[model samples]
Target: MKPAGSLALLALLLAGCSAGSGLTTGALLGDDKPAAPVNDAPARAFQVGTASARAVKCGFNFDPAKLKTNYLAYEKQQPSGQDTAKIERIYDVSFNGVAKAVAGEGEYCSETKTKTIKADLGRHLAGDYTPRVVPKEQEEGLFSGMGSGGSAPEYKAKHPMDNSD
Candidate 1:
């Protein structure tokens, strides 16, 4: 009984040590969330850019002309007392990130990728982005044919009777 209890205590201590052994203070505390971006002007701008980049990576389409228009709209909607330079800096960083992400996707011609990404980022910044949602009918249809001849191509093609030879 004593040996069993000692082994259990040792196991618990080892587990605790392993769990607390992360190099960062946050990791030691078991907190995995990223620290909030700094409040300084440049840092805030970078955060805004990072957020915009992430949005593009998540599938928002690019449209530059619309983005410019949206930026103008956003600028006009800002309170009259806010600092213009700070706002511009944030916008600049955001647009740069957006461009980088869009161009990285390789979905468009090289010449037009930058333009498309810029537009897409602009659309996102203007609050125009929305994730594509499958309609209920379509979702139902997808599962309706499951396990039947009309299911996925791979499964249907692999069915024994599907071979012409």
Candidate 2:
């Protein structure tokens, strides 16, 4: 092949390689938005837990295990020579709110409840909110066995008549 034809083929291959890597030529050229990380595990877990707690406070039965969380890195930047990444974790609470509505057993969460969930999530992500443990009385089955006293154990040596009986 001629030199021009060879150079064109090489360019095409490079373009194909870059595109396959999820970074388009436009992104590489600074014309398109860069891709962000999605559904980060830690962030999602925190969000779901926060939402469930807030829902419980609002008198709704929401299960954290049933909550669905989605995370998106709204902004990410690496300083010119720095090795660390500056990433902003953005939570999609709306989807989880909808999921709560579908999976929840009680009344639908009010708008204020959703806002409180989001606000609490923001505070949690910002390291400002500390989670409060539910009181033992509020937890399920805390008093189910209240009247059952401990039974005394019978020792075989002390009760020698067992075999004859």
Candidate with the greatest TM-score versus the true structure: 1
In candidate 2, stretches whose alpha carbon ends up further than 4 angstroms from where it belongs are 1-44, 47-126, 141-165
Tens digits of lDDT, candidate 2, 60-158: 544433333222222222123221121111122322333433354354456744665655555444533233232223222323334455462211111
Clashes of 1: 5
For residue 131, model 2's alpha carbon misses the true position, in angstroms, by 3.1
Clashes of each: 5, 0
In the range 17-57, model 1's lDDT, one tens digit per residue, is 23233357774685535433233333333334443554455
C-alpha RMSD values across all candidates: 19.7, 24.2
lDDT of 1: 0.42
**Shift of residue 2 alpha carbon in model 1, Å:** 71
lDDT, model 2: 0.36
